[model samples]
Target chain A: MKLIVSVKRVIDYNIKVRVKADNTGVDLANVKMALNPFCEIAVEEAIRLKEAGVASEVVVVSIGPTAVQEQLRTALALGADRAIHVETDELPEPLNVAKLLAKVIEAEQPGLVILGKQSIDSDNNQVGQMLAALAGRPQGTFASEVKVEGGKVLVTREVDGGLRTLSLDLPAIVTTDLRLNEPRYAKLPDIMKAKRKPLDVKTPADLGVELKQHITQLKVETPAQREAGIKVDSVDALIDKLKNEAKVI
Target chain B: MNILLDSIEKVVGSQNVLRGEDVRSRTADWMTKEPCLAGAIVRPANTEQLSEVMALCYEANQAVVTHGGLTGLVRGGMASSDELVISLERMTQIESIDCVSGTMTVQAGAPLQSVQEAADQAEMQFNLDLGARGSCTIGGNIATNAGGIRVIRYGMMRDLVLGVEAVLADGTVVNSMNTMLKNNAGYDLKQLFIGSEGTLGIVTRAVLKLHPQLTATNTALVACEDFNSLTGLLQHARKSLGGELCAFEVMWSSYYSLLTTESNRHTPPISSDAPYYVLIESLGAEQKESHERFEKAIESAFEKGLLIDAVLASSDHQREKLWAIREDVEGLAHLLAPRFAFDISLPILEMDKYVRKLQSAVSQRWKNAKVIVFGHLGDGNLHVSVATGDASDETREAVESLVYEPLKLMGGSVSAEHGIGLKKRKYLNLSRTPAEIALMQTLKIALDPRGLLNRNKVLPDILA
Candidate 1:
């Protein structure tokens, strides 16, 4: 089966997020950006599937600014086959991204579509589901385990309490979770080869997808601070505080 | 694929076979915003079932990925659509807690918080801790060799783990769960899988070493004029508190100010205006002496002019409040659009200069970038975050080179607490020798011959 993994270029999670002074959006003027953490997992998973012979080809697709081609190259370095960069300077909302990606899905018609559940920068965990909806395909989210059998996908989801199992037919959209797989590092040679791989860039106009704004930002403020409390002198005092003041017990 | 499913169903039963929407929930990890792409997820209740699943996967040449608690900072647990994932979620029983031996034998899927609670119930202590303790698993901790607050006293996960039970690619179970503290066995095979990030083998269970519960605890926040004073204060605390000193976390002024800002959760215990702050803690068997010694150490440091100001925690509430400033990094998330969190280590002698150089380099590269530094200074580990005004690949690469290049020249590790998950893989050679990396690959090839177990993770691509 041909596997197509969709990745995104987002601000690295380790970096602190800052709101713009004008409250227009996040200040991304000089921050470090990389492939979304979940997308990296998607790339890793596709490579593994191809290596195991379960997948014939693993293609990567990204819908973002022209610079997102770098992220596509990263996926290629980690072992994706070819890449499609839906080039646009403006980042469309998840729905628009899903729309553009849906076109690519329709064109390539891979058996499976894998993407990150949410982008850490935006925390909008809706793209994969929206894409699945737009593509009219079954979807799985927060998968801890996945297996293929008889042209269907079996996924183990981690719910709040315990594990829940589900199965879906082929040609489905699956988003990645943290516990699904450990992504492999791109080897130096792969990095060089990725530069030579086929990276086809398409414009939003070419794809016939309109860029739309879905979410508006008002203001972003720092989280509230914790209050300081007095330290007691003895264990008995600590016990007293826990019992009466803090009331954790 | 049908044969693989039949074998898995035989091992785990049809009830545990998850697919579709269930697959999506299981596919994504804690860090990723993506849904799971796995073909299926299998939960084995015990090592035997897991072994059987591995055998089937090996026969089918199916790619298998192992899932723990999914709390890793790096994207290690994300699975693909075609690969089969083996989650240890069903194998979470704490088999035994030996109070006398101060050891706990547990299944790999046990949450770290659960282990800590079990140790507490048994009147012992499991010293490993991190922000994700509530969700991270013991196996994941062992895989990442996670380090946290108590690493100053107890060391990393590698030290806390005595022995582990793992299954190789071909269903070979290597049970080396040693309970004793001093096991000078051949090769120390457990080390290979401890921080391999589940590339070599799937850890099934483990025997972890524990410590006697700390009866007396004392905490204090001390202000230092500079790194020299901070080092002097650390030496004083160690000498005075002796083996009782459990934590000595240093916070640079930038971090301290950020934590104590008007909008933050905690007010500064000291002035929050100091150039450097050290949050010190001592845990011992005697409460009175522990407090007395802790107070005396700070008093002497003050007398010696090494300390600018000191606030002793006379109560547990105060202690936690002081620690909140150092431990609560989530609050500072709003300072920069893209924050580059780096956990790098250098020799104590060179750390100050190295940090200054890092700051200078970051400033030179991005004049507006904010460099906030802090960490377990006692352990030669520094947690740095460079806030780039704009989030871009160029800025990320520039920041990484600025922070990592100094470590190569200073004989420091690229990663001190965090493992080289895909993010830091290229810089692995900064601290490790070429021969060392080669040995890692040799071991990887030996254990996972097909390179299917977390393939392409820690070791660089050998074919390259």
Candidate 2:
């Protein structure tokens, strides 16, 4: 069985991003970028499956500009057999990205596909479900744990209230949540070998998918700074201020 | 104390002062959870206000303790019950970043991480970095002359600092903020304040020298068979890496095994069974060339029997993983609770024999003692941690004597990068000659004649 894991490059979680002056989006110039943390969990799940002998090969796929190949290389170094880079000037919206991934799924015919529940940048959480709908496959999203047995993948999802288990047939879609697995660091030797691993590049045109935008970002502004609170001398002063100044007592 | 607080409030606004329970609620330092017992915590927003507060303290002969991030293991920043804590918490501001000159002027209270971030924003690198970077302040780094992982290449905090502005204990402001690379005009007075542990003066601001950001970083964790091979590997790495080498951290087998076997946390990337592991990192301009050279050096080292096995990090994540193993000092403390940790410096050639003697001495004292050793082998600094499942004052004294007593004969320093704070003040003479100690005392008495600044720290009381 073959497994396909999807990854995305995003700003490092540790960094404090600044808003651009024009407010179109975050100013990413001269910022550190890493593999999307949730996507790392997804890639780790796929590698674990391969290591468990439930899967033979793991192919990591990324849909973005040339710079996103860095994330693909990271995935490869973390144990992916190869990488498929869907080259595009700008990444399309979730529905269209699902259409393009559906094309790759049809072409590759993998037994299972794993993706992050949501990228930290967008937080859309739509691509995996849309891809499953386009490919006519069952999806076990937000999977905290995943196990493959008897041509089926058992996914334990982290629901709002508690755990929810579901068994999906082969050729299913799974979106990994944070508790899925901890990703391993790419070893130095593996990183050197990842450079030699095959990375096939394709375009949306080659997949016969036309890009369509369903949403337009109007402006991106940082949240308003919190007002500093004043310290009251005593309980009496606090009550007096709340009653007289705040007028909410 | 109340009258002194009132005078301090006149210099710095009353709102800036934290008193009574507020001062007592805060922890003394990062190493301990004990509630601080200072009379008050005075936070001045700027250097001028700090000088004013210092002037008041001098007039009253009131003892003052300067506080940075307080992450130091030594009790340098610890204040007594009556002493007032003059904290730089409010002075945290990066005043300017000179891109052309490659220098930054920052207030002392700014965290090292914030300074590093600002340097990153300017596309420059601040070479002084350590595990406490996020918590440690620029003032603390300057005061202690912090020697971190990159000290092998960038030298200590002393080398990274261009100029410093400090307030003398008597409230005199000394402004020698020179940013030039070479200014041999007169005495470099900044050296007097740095590494002085706030006994001479309180650092308020500094002009820090920055380096051009190195784009390429190559890191590896390699295994060596024995101490000789480890030293040989260091020589080989330095030769092959040349000026690119920034860090050469070595971990003994015990330290490596302890850090890795946590299993649920900090998974080891390679086998921890190796006798020694060296985390080598190099920074350069050309990524491909540096990576190739790093790999070639490792290959040659293996061929020369300097390394038994090695793993190189191909990406930033991998590099961070290799560093995490070395930087997990807190985990080391947890694995050996109530441990007596020593940071000592000796010649590289004497390290193996010193460890053997120390090991034998420790085992003779306690048959079941567990000792873990690791440090920046490049700078000849080793951090030795000993644990014997006993936490008593007498046991601690015995352990400290055992560690520092042997170093005197070995011509090694009892305190390496960590200064002679309250912790190692008793053993100052072990590492210093009588003449050297006298000169240090003369300088201390001349600068802080009242002995009110950081009292009972750095210099022993007997010297006074």
Candidate 3:
């Protein structure tokens, strides 16, 4: 069985990000970029399946600017067999990216397709479900556990109450949760080899999908300033302030 | 074999199958646990069937291991051959992103980056971050109480989580997805799983608090002549930068030089020869004002003789290069063979003396052993690496004792950001008191009566 994993490039969450002055968006001129955390988990899960010999080949794909190919390279380094980069300078919206990814999925025709639940930069959780809908496949979202039995996929989902389990047919979309698998670091050797791996670069024109930006940024501004409160002399005074002023008691 | 396979098939259906060698990969975590290893791996799709699966496992006395994004430094998720591996790879979904409430409710398997992004999309920020944010699950972060660079400004994973839902050892679902920031109703059951490292129960979902996104950030690389100067700079930055002071990371000369060596990508910001270097950052609403204040703070420190030399990041590229010096620990990792990485915390006042004493002790014992130190100094946390000339059982024990023994007297902790996995299990007592240790064991037993979840971790062995 073949597995296709979708990943995205995002700002490293550890570094505090600031929106640009023009109110356009976050300043990404020289920001430290990385693979979206959930997407990395998705990639790790796919690679693990391949390593276990359950999956024949792991193919990674991403829809973004040419720069996103770096994230795909990272996935390849982590043990993906090849990658597909849907090159677009502008990330139009969740639905557009999903549409592009669905096209890639149809072409690859992998047994399983995995995606991060959301992207760190956009936090749009619609892509995976949208891809599932576009692909006309059942989705196992927020999966905590996944097992392949006979010809069906059993997925354990982390839900409001607890873990919920379900079964889906083959050729399904599974969005990875954090607990899926610990992603392994790409060793130096693997990083070198990933450069030589097959990377198929496609464009919106090639996919025959029209890119559309659904959301427009009216203004991007920082949160209101948090004033420095008076330092209490003692615990009793602190409690009084918390109760009276902050009312966080 | 058919009976076991048949039982699993009853819950997940015929297609979800794993047997024999396929089970080995899921059996053990990084630390390698024995008894709770997976005899099979059952992947259930939703909560109801997972409950049924857990019920079956509990009835059969078969230990079940819940797996999420496995980037945990600790072995809390490791399974054994007699157990079953229940992976959450399919349950990754963002249930909701509440903009008004400033919260995001997500499945336990959702990656930390995914939650952070969801918060970002809502024009809010999830303050919980770490090096493993790309691969680690929010559940694992909660389980480990993960702390990253932002711990100084936003606190740890414990501070970010409003509520959680987890499955007990017996597969009983405990849902406590509280969205309110101030919910003091009862025991705060979410606390039980927040830092327990997945031993008590398997966390499946969480409601995490979010903050408004910052608009501006100012970063700098400064050189300190001594520990006193470092402390002085920290105080001045805290007072002058006001609430905007977000990060104050320190790097020893040894660490800085190692990064700036010929083969490395980073060039020394100042000289790579200072006794100590600090990477300071401030995030605020006004970039112009924050930059002005940052400049003034450094100017004041320089006048007061607290700083010898300082370089403000003029451009984003320069700023990144400066940070690369601090974040690149791989240089030190390469230089040292058989290195033991230690993350510890001590009171700010006691840190200098403690480091000196530990260095002297290590030198006396090993002669050629090198100790490199650096960390988030603002939060009193330090990451120490001891590269030994020889790797032996006795050498390891001696090095550990020398490094950890001083921490006890200085009222410091053995494991700071990193949880006490198998590596630091024996040294737990160096930090926690006997009464605290006893209470921890009691909680472990009370919650996991069968000792099935992440056994023999985070706590020391009981004395006879």
Best by DockQ: 2
Give per-residue CA lDDT, model 3, range B207-291, as digits (tens): 9888887756667777889999999999999899888888899988877776776446576656766798888888776655776
Against the native complex, each candidate's DockQ, computed on alpha carbons, is 0.01, 0.21, 0.01
Error of 2 at A223 (Å): 5.2
**Model 3, residue B338: what's the lDDT?**
70
Candidate 1's displacement at residue B103, Å, is: 1.5
lDDT of 1 by residue, B1-464 (tens): 66788779988998777777887875365533578788888999999998988888888888877888886666677678778878889889999998888899999999999999899878699999777788889999998899998888999999999999999999999999988888786889899889889999999999999998775777777788988888888888888778888888999998888778755677665676789988888887765466567666766777788888776553344466777777776676655446878889999989888878878878887788889988998999999989978767888888888889878887899899877777788889888999998998888888988878976677788974
lDDT of 2 by residue, B19-73 (tens): 8889888999666677888888999999999999899899999999999999888
TM-score of 2: 0.85
* Location of the lowest summed lDDT over 10 successive residues in candidate 2 chain B: B261-270
Candidate 1 local accuracy as lDDT?
0.83
lDDT of each: 0.83, 0.89, 0.80
Highest TM-score, which number?
2
Q: Calculate each model's fnat, 2 decimals.
A: 0.00, 0.18, 0.00
DockQ of 2: 0.21
> What are the runs in model 3 whose C-alpha is more than 4 Å off?
A1-249, B1-6, B13-38, B262-265, B461-464
- Tell me the alpha-carbon RMSD of every candidate: 27.7, 4.1, 21.6
What lDDT score is found at residue B194 in candidate 3? 85
| Model 3 lDDT, full chain set | 0.80
